[model samples]
Target: MPNHDQLPTDEERDMLRGSVRGFLGQHIAGARTVDAGRQTERQLWKQLANLGLTALGTDPGQGGLREVVIVQEELGRAGCGSPLLSAALLNLSGVVEQANDERVAAVLAGMHTGDHCIPLAFGEFDGDRSAGRPALRSDRLTGDIAFVEGAEGATHFAVFTAGPVLTIVDADAPGVMIEAATAMHLGGQSRVRFADAPTVRVPLNKDGVDNLVAIARLGYAARAYGAARRAFELAVAYAKERKQFGQAIGRFQAIQHKLANCHIDLQGVELTIGSAAKQYDAGARDWHWFAAAACVLAGDALRQVSLETHHTFGAIGYSEEHEAPRHFKRIHLDVLRHGGARPARDELADRFLGGTPDRLPEYDLGPAANEFRGEVRAWLLEHWSGERRAAHQQPPFAEREYDRAFALDLGRTGWIGLAWRKHFGGQERSAFEQLALMEEMERAEAPRAGAPVQAAMLQVYGTPEQRRKYLPEILNGKAIYGMGYSEPDSGSDLASLRTRAVRDGDHYVINGQKIWTTTYWGEYMLLAARTNPDSKPAHAGISMFIVPMDTPGITIQTSTTMYGGTFANVFYDNVKVPAANMVGDEGNGWKVLTGALATERGFIGGGIVLKVAHAFELLCTYLRGVETDGKPMRLDPIVRQKIGDLAARIESGRQMMLYCAKQVDSGETPPHDAAASKVYSGELMERFGEVALDILGLEATLTEGSPGAILRGRIEQNLRHSLMWVISIGTNEIQRSIIAQRGLGLPR
Candidate 1:
């Protein structure tokens, strides 16, 4: 609660992370490339055993559940193939969950020892079974369960029987044929076949299907999170190192702002996976739907990170050796292998329409979610009219001034500190309120810049003086601030930043280079620097300084992104700041940062970014104007499909975004909801960019300033800018780790 930067506290999270990370480090990290695309990694399994990664799903009498989930996450990270998924689902839980046999315990034991691997296979294309009728001996799962992962080494198969039944079989048995490992996305995960495999009988009636689906969905969600984390990490690392125009890609306002957006998305991902995992652990049931949602977000996150990491890396990332292609491939496989994002839609539709509607997770927004809706609606009606709508319609994401205003308005309305305690500029809102407010903002397309997150941090750790000085400035629209955290040499390893501030009587004279300062144009900046580098720990010696832009000896050098505009490189040469301007006690910067980032479940995917909307609008307008390939480009199935997919992603993203908002509104974090949504929304934007360029063909090659440039080359600009969204923030890869580690209690 102290900070968004504060790390997770659960011991299960740390232990799981260490165990799985150790396993990957020992086995797959340096494995030879047995095959270019498809690796039949036999030696890899024993290593997983040596590190005790395979038996994670077993009850504590054997090992731990958290460990197994971490293994799933690691599997995605390493892009290493393993059949432990099968063991956990089918042999360990699925088939036994239905049968009353001692074999269940034996299989569970085998799984713990890595004696056998088990996997389950059921798909959207698994042929329709006649309702309430017997599964024909010949029906035999007539459709291919495409992109099935972990079946290669599965000792037993748990096949989804029609309705609520599970049919189990030995993978090595007659009628079950193991096919050569096939290539998909990521690297080694594979797909195999039934080809009329004989069924293991499940009686006509049973209810293990739900359990079976949960195991599979949750596993994939973990995998997705892992992949997303790697993608995000790669993006962030790439942004920090990759130079563009004349400086690191990070030192551009457009890039830094985009990265801020990316960070929000990553926070969302952490919330989703963590929430879903908690539910699973609680035996909350309905893990099927919960895990489904997590996967949807994970897929979204993975796709977004993969695309952006490549963009951030440019040509280097595009080449096969860069690891970007493999990560992208993994995203596609994990998403499509299951019913894809469509199932999430079906699940949501079913939750809202199938049940008593009133029974859908009683969103206890304290004042019921609808109550806040009514109140906000009343407030809007009383306040928002022609002038207000006109003023607000300037597109929240694009209007810098309005963005600050939105934050001020929300602060005035007491919505900005919805989650903080009433004692300190907050309403002490519940998780539901926080989530609800976020959803409301998204729905209203409200701007959120003035609040700048640092306000929340101040509430947690700011001295009374700091609060009095800055909170009002933030709440009102008087002061705008930039995050001057990263410097020339420090990015991910932020503790090592080199900026310095020396004590000088009533002030501290600071001098150093600060790059990647977002919105350097802002009036005030939150600068993290070293006040005592000789102090024992690097983290402890740091301090936060609130320096006014007008301070003497400060030169802000601007760097343009591949897009446009700048994130400035700030040079503080003996710039004096009063000692009173410090945020808290000196040598407490890291502590303050930790407090700031704790429980930071938030927006995933960039805000309904204007860049994406602009791209879509432009593509639509272009499609209407001309024909391509002998037919209007708008009419082609591929074009239509891309558009259709984007629309679905957009809509789903909106809901997930709202869901994330709901969690935030109630004063509860929304990690799983946020991560998945952010991932999906960001990726969808990239997808739109790629599809738009393909449709534009040569037209996209033109620069905006060129004589014959097409539509001022907006598509090209968007393509270039989209990379920033994925690379900034947590990077999709880091997001996945959060999901896997914090969300699912998986091994890191």
Candidate 2:
């Protein structure tokens, strides 16, 4: 039923984007100047029809929602307004539902040629048509329709009314009055009043109207994304050229971080919109849900990007002559078209809170990956479900996150090294399969397995003997590793660690104190210490080693974490590790350490977000049966909105993870992308925890084993634990700096 193969390739989409962009570039001088009156708008609509864009919504062979998205985005990028949303998408969708009716068929045919301009007046400002629906008695329409776009020169009005019927009424028909309403960013909005106006009824159902609105919302979101992206580009260009204090403003970390944040926000908006379009094209059952989620996220993220873009540009950006203002207007106005994000959020809340509770949509990660996901799901069902999972989950939250027996069982299946290379004793599976494995593991709430970072470092930089001894140990669950990069004072600024490892005859005598050593109980530590302390760059003096935890001088002082788990302040006093255990050449530890860190951050990004998703799922499940003050919790408007917001953000994080995995599959070690993923996902976990508590109230703060605790007190524990994700694996602030420097090419 879902023909993903029919979807456009990247090259095809690129070509389409180029063509649309080039066309817009030629016609529209600027966004603010695009509203040249009704006649000019009509002329542009005809041009779009000639280019086959007007037919895209009606003819599957011409193109589909994806093509529409490209056109809309280009329109927004150029800061030009078009009737694509109104005439092409909304009205055309309604007409197609009643194409067998001669009047509707004629209207649809005229629309393809850009000869008809029938904007649908189906809803109020808040997207509720039912509230003030026109009386549709005796085949006549009566009442006022508000917030109709492109109504200035429309050939007819497709009015949806109280009987849930669609009627085509002539703009100048008896008792019909069209009056200019308040201006929007794009202009050409009006109110239409009909006092028993004569009309032709086109048979259509509420489903048809819902579909029409969904299409319009998606189109508007694309436009918002395009506008936000253009604004960000303008800010970046200005930052590169705007000098301050004797250097480019972009060189400043403040500017860099601001622009980097805009970049991340744009990524979320773009990815969500793309996924929604693809789902719509595939005829997926949950396509509407995807559409709503896209709108909600785009409305929030793009709006923020637009605002931050101006913030980056400073005073000059506020000028109407500058490009930023137009895009800002476009993003704000376009996103709020179908009652903005609120209505979309309400739609999502209805689905999530009203029913048996549906799971998040599963993305199509390709055939091999799809099949592999199924296999992983089945395997998880068999190996880690019911009583065993219950028993594993009974411990304090942090302690339950990993299990040796489970890790050993999973390691025996060879899945722990799924994405490692072949020569290094791995199956060398695709990254998507690896993602599938991680996703399924998180979905099943299974314990983590193996030392992936240590295994990766050994595969790349370890000596031959080291690899032989250590690789299998990590792969077969025979060993685990503690990271020894941070000291009491050197956490985020890891290169500044005071750890020292002086080379002796055949061993490295290490002396350092590492704090927050999460795996201090493991067999070995992947340690980073300064070897050439006098080296000019400071970081170049570092070296990496594998130190056995059982070394005579090693002392572990464990401290309890706020999340009820323990980490150690490990003191390595005259500990002797064989020089043969060194991961890479001495004084090259920065590269080796960063390489391992990159891998760790990539999965950490994925792992943290997946954990939030699992927790969100649990929260949703709990809310479905909850009641307060005599009403269902799910029925509470505040509860519905919060859950909807969480669902959309979680989806955005999921897309970001998939994007990072895609980069890895393409042979790219995307450190910046990984950083972006890490930053967004880590922060999202924090936000989700807060929102869970807000919705669940005080009971959510209860601890494990407490009387009448909610979700075994996991919600509050997660709220506390979320702080670790943002702090561990490098702080979010550090990740933002990486994104600025590496992702956006901002000056350090």
RMSD of each: 11.9, 2.5
Clashing pairs in 2: 31-79
For all predicted structures, in order, the TM-scores are 0.51, 0.94
Candidate 1 stretches with Cα past 4 Å from truth are 1-9, 30-43, 46-69, 91-97, 102-105, 123-146, 185-207, 242-265, 283-292, 318-321, 350-748
Q: Model 2, which residues run further than 4 Å from truth? A: 1-3, 90-98, 101-103, 124-143, 170-178, 181-186, 193-198
Tens digit of per-residue lDDT, candidate 2, span 1-748: 1245665677887888998899888988864555356787678778887887777755554567888888889988998766676665543354665568787788767877888877776643238443246778798888888766667667788777655677888877899887775544445556788899988876666776778778788888998899888888878888888999999999998898898888888898889898888887888888888888889998889988888888888899878888888888778888887677888999888877877777777878889999999998999999999999999987766677678998899888888888878777789998888888888988887877799888989888988898889898888877889899888789988778899999899999999899998889889999999988899798999999999889999988999999788899999899999999888999999999999999988868888888998898888888899889988999998998998898899888988998988888888868889998899998999999899889987888989999989988889888888899999988888888898888887777
- Residues 181-289, candidate 1, lDDT per residue (tens digit)? 5455233344445556665455423445545555566666677657666766776666666676778776554544444444445454555565555445545545445
lDDT at residue 8 of model 2 (Cα atoms): 62
Instruction: Assess candidate 2 and give its TM-score to the true structure.
Output: 0.94
* lDDT of model 1 at position 459: 76
Candidate 1, residue 344: Cα displacement in angstroms equals: 1.5
lDDT of each: 0.59, 0.83
Candidate 1 local accuracy as lDDT? 0.59
